[model samples]
Target: MKTAADIIIELIEKFDVHDAGSRRAHGKGEHHKARVELNEAGKDIFGEVENAVVRLSNAATNDKVPDWLVNIKGCSVRFNHPLRPIDIIGINFPYFPFDSAAETLDVLYRIHFYLEDKSAGRFMDIFRAGGLYRDLGKILKWMPKSTDMDHLYYTAHSYGGEHYKMKLDYHPGNDRIEIYAEKDEHLIDYHPGPAVHLGSILINPHSTGKEVKYFDVLNAPPGMPPNGNLPLLRHYVYKRSFLRRMEEKLLDGKDLRMLEEVWAEEKYFVLSKSQRIYDEIRELVKKGTDMSATRFRELLDEAYALKYEEKHLRNYLQHVWGHFKDEADESEKAHYTRLSEHPDPEAVNTFIHDLAIKYKEPYILRTTMVKTRGRS
Candidate 1:
């Protein structure tokens, strides 16, 4: 049976969207290493936020479409946390037409359809489900028309279910904002919304030598697991898109460091699981041992098993909490249920991290996800 995810992948392949399985929908964009400080209000919502990485892209019809011509803009912010990082994704428009990922996929179809047919009549379908269609004004308003991101208001319409819903908004900045490079976090939240200001993004540009880093769309904060059909299908598209992009980069002989780092940290063999095994191998190297292929293979296998345990254990704790809670003592059960239902946003990741690292020490690593910038 062709599930929604299967259909999404098919559409991605059909249009040959460059950034399909990644960035949610913002494929063509720039990434920046940003410093995020919470305002008094923001601090209340998101405590002690570390600096972050941001992706700013044009939510245009295609890669060839100009940023200003696009009706929407996409921004994804990833706070720097060794484990259990938070990802807040949003668009320039105040509200998204669709409430879920499936709706977003429909928007994608509408976009490609409009582009191919070059007909507003088709795109402005009154019967179109969710987004733009029902609101004729919005349909025209959200067409690609932004002059630039500096003055544009980008919003994160993300919901961590009912328990954790936040409004992370960016204020409208002027030409001076873009004119000056490396604008700090305070400049744009220069405040964008009614809610607490959610820091600013310093869009980092890359030149010849610099490396381009990408945020992992899969890594959602605890208590905010992106489950359900929409997320499933959306993630499928993201994964496939990323893999395709990586493959293309490989073929083009582009630097693969970023991909390697993403895989090491985010993918199957995460840093925590593999780092110790790597350290063991390092010790072998320091001792001047032969370090045969068999030994290396064994270490990799160990890392693989450890990673499997990490994944399965996380799943078990989050989903099968009821069964385990039944067996545990009162305090343990309460703790499990509290976290399972409504977790303390600040502590959940650390708690999960502690559990995952019960045997292994936490592995903290950083990667530029790029190389050099502005090479002549």
Candidate 2:
């Protein structure tokens, strides 16, 4: 029996989406950092979170697709938990198309093949294999077009054992509803379970149009499922892809700077970049250059926190390498072949460059970078 990670790795390899540089899927995105003062409802679940990094994405496989082409859209809210942040991932649909993680992955695989082959027989085979055939069928025929992401109620589904499910409620008029301290025992995603109406997310009025790069789902709370499929699976596949590329870079023995270029896009790149800035600031402080010591101290604290997160992630991956190694080689081989023959090598670059330019409209991506002081 293959592990969930193994199946994910297979999906990562077989799909052309993972071949892209940073993100595996939904690479077309806009990022933001906001100050969040949790209301009583949110405070109950998350005690206090000062800052958060948010990313909104068009549910695109690659950068080529325009907004509204795909009915699905996603947003990830990563709470800045001082030590380690957790991302609350959500989509436009109130409930996921599939019933379980296992089923979700299985259906995704079948759907991909069906799209390529277009065999009606193979299409119904998915319905025959899964109990929720009607739901899956509905998903296949769901809105293939979506012009506005603002009105749709983006639904959260990262529930492991939590009693709450969040919805980014901007539905209709005056849709913002306050969440009370009560659990709504209702059926969602075709299952009857106790849930809480996690209040709507509103953009901070003060800060707008702030520059943000991208959001990582790796920071999700411990034991929470970061979806069984794409959008965030790039974290693992990214490391694998990085290592393979590094190996080939060594074998070719070409420009050593190419290694710098490659490593700059990986996970630790930001840390080193931060470290460089820290060093520059340290020198200024040593020179007795007049500056805000308070701001300097805050910078130091954030750097230390990020360093701790880096170390923690490295240790975790090292521990799990043995388990994930089973399918590592096969996945690498698949991506390597694509690297050799892929005609549009610039697709990834285009997607990345477009992030800063394409997502300017407030509806597509909001301007939010507020420093929340106290809870509402």
Cα TM-score per model: 0.55, 0.50
Q: What is candidate 1's lDDT per residue for 214-305, written digit by digit as tens?
A: 44434554334432334334444554445444433322323244444444443223233454565665554343223232444345445545
State each model's CA lDDT, in order. 0.44, 0.43
Which sections of candidate 2 miss by over 4 Å? Answer: 1-3, 12-19, 97-102, 136-145, 151-162, 170-376
The segments of candidate 1 whose C-alpha lies over 4 angstroms from its true place after superposition are: 1-3, 16-25, 60-63, 100-127, 130-132, 138-145, 151-156, 161-194, 198-232, 251-255, 261-376
All models, RMSD in angstroms: 11.3, 17.6
Tens-digit lDDT string for candidate 2 (1-376): 3334346545655766533443445556666555665666576565566666666667665766777666677666667664345556566665555434466577667867776788988788666545666666555554435556553433334433553455444332432222222222232352324445444444443333442333443444433333434323334343333333333232222323333232233322223225454454455344332433334434433533353233433332233233333444565435433433441323312222233123222211111100000000
- Candidate 1 minimal-lDDT segment of 10 residues: 367-376
Cα-based lDDT at residue 232, candidate 1: 37
